[model samples]
Target: MTERETTYEAPQGEGRDRQPAGQASPAERSVGDSVFHRHERAVDEVPDQPAVIAPGEKYQLSSAGRRWRIGEIFKLLRKYEVWNDITPVRLRCLLEELGPIFVKMGQILANRSEILPQRFCDELRKLRTDVDPVPYTIVRDCLHAEYRRPLSEVFSWIDEEPLGSASLAQVHRARLVTGEDVAVKVQRPGAQQVMAQDIDIMRSIVRLASHFVQTDQFVDLHDVVEELWESFREETNFIMEARNLDDFYEFHLGTKGISCPRPYMKLCTEHVVVMDYVDGVSISDPDALIDAGYSLKQLGSRIVEDYSTQVLDDGFFHADPHAGNIIVKDGVVYFIDLGMVGRMSNHDRLIVKDIIYSVAEGDVPKLKDSLLRFAVSRGDSGALDHAAFLSDLDYIVADFAGLDLKDLDIGEFLTSLVNLARKNDVELPSVVTMFARGMVTLEGLLSEYMPHVNMIQIIRSHIANEKSTYKRLEDGARELSVESLRAARGTLEAAEHIGLATRMLTRGQLKVNTQIMGSEEVLRHVGGIVDRMSMSIVIAGLFIGSSVVYYAKIEPVIFGIPVIGFLGYASALILALGLGREIWRNGHARK
Candidate 1:
């Protein structure tokens, strides 16, 4: 409602923004036209233009995007490379300068096959969240704004330089007035607004891509963007992350040597998070960990086992456990950054357990069966060559067959297996993919930390724990209980039916007619009579209403005639034609 704000309504057909008259919109041109007509109608409403910055010119500040201008950003990128690269390199560069929302969007875009080219994705995968820190004055100002007090009153001393900088927030080391050292994560000013705007852009991107691309086999592109939006919202809210840390710590409480950061939640807010400061070498640095007398092999196994417990045992696990998010100090592993987490239900956990079991056991037939059963889409089971798939799966797990753990790359192996599954028209869940990616990330860190670490043994041990005899017995008992109830109910129902049949036969009152709808003709005429009578009355009303309106000359006329009267006449005409068509169809049926 503000005069300063701008809105862009999509131009209808024949408008400048519409596609050329003969050209079909995305829905009309989609591979599966039978997908849905409503989808086509919706897609046709969008302006036939992508908002991406075009080559050889600065980005156009469209009405919807006019709130923020990036002419300076585009100018800076033009220094290293021209605008015509047709690569995501420039886009990635621009996103880095634009801040957190753009950075998150770039990260999400890496997986969007429908909207982004693979090459662009390849370049974007290299994008990192190592942004520059704001000045100490800004941090001080933020603290003042949040607490409504001076920084000196809250903190005894705070570091001017940030410990590390990321897309949404930057971390700083500080000491509380009470003398406890803590890490302060300060959210960028106006970050929520920027994130909201970028999510709106992402929605537009996904909707546009859905019109033309086929991403239905695994995940819906729009749904993925929506998930990312929700994730962004959670990540931005520091209070939510504090709760995650607390919950994760509670889940692993009393477990030997495994830990997550403890939050001082009273001092936390939507914009700032304060947690106990932890001093440890990054897990990626194996030399430091080894020099500090920590066992790399033990660390690797313990971490994987912990995640395994989180996934199968607890049904909740950190989704993002990259090397950067993990730390090792004095033989203890600490998981950090609890923004993105994944949760599974008991049923999903069972499916994952079977998957891990089959893969670790290297049982090709069992693996194939589990994959087919667990996949989100089991496409054309009959069309799949089960023997060939099993053979291929055997080759895929050939590395896992032996216990030479150092040479085996578990992450790559799992990815290949999932890729093979996809090729065979088996689509797995998002959690499955996330789990594999997390494993791959851990594998890289483990390999770097301890080249000879036997992760296979650890993973197998944890999986064995998941597939314990007690769990099997419990599951069997549960199934048996349900089956017994169902069978008992069936027996009782059968006896009742038998008793009724006996009474009917004894009384000589049993009657049966095998033919379905024996009275179809009479019912059909009766229904037809009712339908025609209603249609006739409605049509007559329409005609009479139109005549009355035309004679009365109602106000707000269209083309020298009342619009309502014209609509009434059009409705009557349509109904009469429909009636005539129905009669003709019925006559043909009779003939």
Candidate 2:
């Protein structure tokens, strides 16, 4: 059998009682006790079931349950008087009381200072995900169920006290049987089930609220829910986290001054992850680093430099780089918690490069183009007001013109640019937003370490150093060649069209079609004028005929007037009065 198959399967001829091949042992059975597993089993039992279900269906909550949860949420909102006045502290408190999903949402929003006020972002940043630790016995039982072999075969020792506990999982330091120290991250039992239910509830609330509220004016409720769901999915799947660690480890191979934990793939599963244990000072505690004889400025500079490399060169970066996720050991910075990361394609990276370069050079048009290229348009492109967008961009660029790198705030600048894009009906990708938030978090860390260190300057320097002059020249030449070919093709197409038109003209078969803009409205006005003129002519005829008839009176008369003439006169007066009122109303409307 293959190595992967062996890793998950029970060993053959073991001394312990063995089930038939492909049958799960008691330990394996116990591992499937979570609701997520039960749901999977239930689905598997069904015949001809599709591979996937809608999010609402997959994360099902009964009608009554959903209503009750929504009621609780509304009550909390009312209690805080969120509609009338929502302070930063009150918002934070509401999120905390709402539960983990809401707290996660607040944490994400905390990074979006461009959308929220800085004070609100600051208050949200203060949100702590530390929850009460799961009992040690439960942790042990979970680990035992995950391992096919006995616990003693894998870990020599595991600390009863958790190293740290968070909303999703808790970490504990353990020593492997191979005498290497490792950190084991165990998922809380039924954590995924609870998170899934909460997400479903959130979706329901957003959907219900959307009917009576125009929330899209401020934020995309559906997008926020999806983003939260995506984050939750990644953060809960320890297997994906293990893979991320492996990839990041490979990325940092032979690199210096920066590292990530090396995951033990054999020991990792959906519910558990075992990786190299980092025993280092958390970057959050600057005092300890200073006591450890580390230069804070150098550390901060290194972080910014390494992060730039991760983003621009590697394209994969740690999405959440809060101080807690970073540690310093012997001057080496270790980025941990690979649950969340961001990625940019080569095309996106180039556009980002152009955006940064254009901003630095104060090229407003170029900046606008790069931003538009990076943004995803929600409406008709033709409907976009490019001139107005450019004007706004010009204002933003002017604010940053001639500013020294050290004085520039990268996070604030990115936020402004994103906000401008949003205001102009353009949306940047979620990864870009994620990167912006990561930068803001990084900047916050730098403030504590060394306030003067400029992240943008570091990024600029890194970009310059990343490519040689010859390489850049080659890239420029390639781009020029591509553009030249496009231009030549366009010229040829124009010539062909002209030749056809000339031949048609020589043959006396040429025709031209013209259309005036706003012709529909013009035609409607013309029709109205004609109707009014026709009515006036009829009115004049009626008055003239009635006068003639009255003067010629040769038939029965009523009070010295012919009956037909009298009726005509009455009709003409009524018509004239009606026409006059319409004319007067139209004249007043114009005014």
Candidate 3:
């Protein structure tokens, strides 16, 4: 019990590597000391600790519900003759017992069908976020406070009954005084508090779960939950949603094909967002849409073309494109709920294009290299799995080869690739997952309508266009070489100046009259002088090399013919001689 209690202390925030500028408090100092001692103790005698929970909470079934014990989670399968198949059914049952947050988490997990088994995602895909609507009084009060107006002045007709209620917010059909039809997305009062509490619990559970479940280590589950929390928090703020809607409107301005619901600025508030209601059949109901005189194939193509343009061309996209969030009215696709959108930096956008082009051309090594470089630079360490990652890519390319262009499950493949990367400990860049989820949902919606549309061929054409753009980018990079050279020269000069200044400043030595100091102290001081001399030599060589590389752009062998190359070699030798002299003088004086 004592040992368990001791192990339960929270992990220190990764020591000096992660510490911010602020001075450490006494408590923090103690924690750092303890961490160092504990690490040393482990080296002497490794203790058996509970399993690791990678990125999320450390959930014990007991915390949520005593009906199931941690032991029972595994034991029930054995006792109930269900041990042979722990498939999606067992998972769904567990999530149901765990409650709403877990259900929503499961649904998010479901979207990553590639990383998770199809059976599991299929089962969790059924998990919905519909909760009982809060009382109309609570909703009205929230609306009043958020908008700072009486409910009467805001809408000509506001329905008390919610169109849909979820964990975060509820949607109600309403009309503005201007007579524009709209959906009033109202936040439930205190949802932020509820979500924060739930997330705290989830985080705790994820921390502990990682210890017991090896899979938890594959994904940064804690980071995933934290990101989800931030996403949902933004969803609660109607102002951000309004901004997202506006961003989308501007994003699709030149194009006639893509459209997002127009937010009524006057009617929108922190708690309530009023947008032109999309009065169309849901994307999920393809047959109904087809019957409504819409060409399913055309609709599918439009979805692909529009979304591809948003992600690839504009670099901003709706992260969630579930059928519920998209509607088709008169063949025009209307996007609703712009709470979660993905934004890619120009660099990442280029990397994504590279990935797309590589995937289209079936360039394995290029794809692998691009993915690894991107992952290493853009993602955290725990988020990448190098070997399994490559294997998954291989399988994805090989598995989906012979399908008709339109019938190809591009979304599934991408999602699976992301999930594979995630599961193998590669933390996917947020934009990549956003693209993956958006593409998957778009593809899924499209496939329902256009059974024969060749998505692969379409994407291939898009990739060709992207390649042209990439060439332009390459030319721009070449243009930047001049700027890069100037920057490199400035940096080298600054380093040289700093080195000279430090040397001048430290030329005078402090003589401590400590009679008790022995031969070991002398040796330590001599060793420190040697180390500094060695570092000076390395820095001097680097400075000379930088000058040669930046200005001359020439590789220098000792036997190089040119003046600058020979100068670089001579400069390096002089620095080495100076360092050797310093070492000799310092070492002799110490002796």
The full ranking of all candidates by lDDT, starting with the best, is 2, 1, 3
TM-score, cand. 2 vs. native: 0.76
**lDDT per residue as tens, model 1, 237-342:** 8998999888888998988888888899988987789998999999878778778888777787788888878877888888778788999766678999988877
Please, what is the TM-score per model? 0.61, 0.76, 0.61
Report the C-alpha lDDT of model 3 over 468-536, residue by residue, as the tens digit: 777978977987998899999999999998887777668854344574333566888888877886778
lDDT, model 3, position 191? 52
Residue 344 in model 1: shift from native, Å?
A: 2.1
Ranking according to TM-score, highest score first = 2, 3, 1
Q: How many backbone clashes does candidate 2 have?
A: 0
Using alpha carbons, what is the TM-score of model 3? 0.61
Highest lDDT: which candidate? 2
Q: Looking at model 1, which ten-residue stretch has the lowest summed lDDT?
A: 3-12
For residues 1-591, could you state the per-residue lDDT of candidate 2 as single tens digits? 553233222224332222222222222233325434544454557534523446765444466645566787788889999988789999999888776788989987876665578899899988877777766656666775566345777877777667998867889888888889899999877566556767988787778887788654335556678899999988888999999999899998878889998999999988899999989999888899889998888888899898988888889999888889999887789999989999888988888888889999999989988887887764546356677788998888888867888778788788788778877778889888888888888987787667767788789989888789999999999999999999999999999999999999999999999866446778988998998899899889999998999999947798999998988889989999999999899899989
Model 3 spans > 4 angstroms off: 1-87, 93-100, 111-116, 211-219, 376-408, 419-426, 465-591
**Residue 2 local lDDT, model 1:** 33
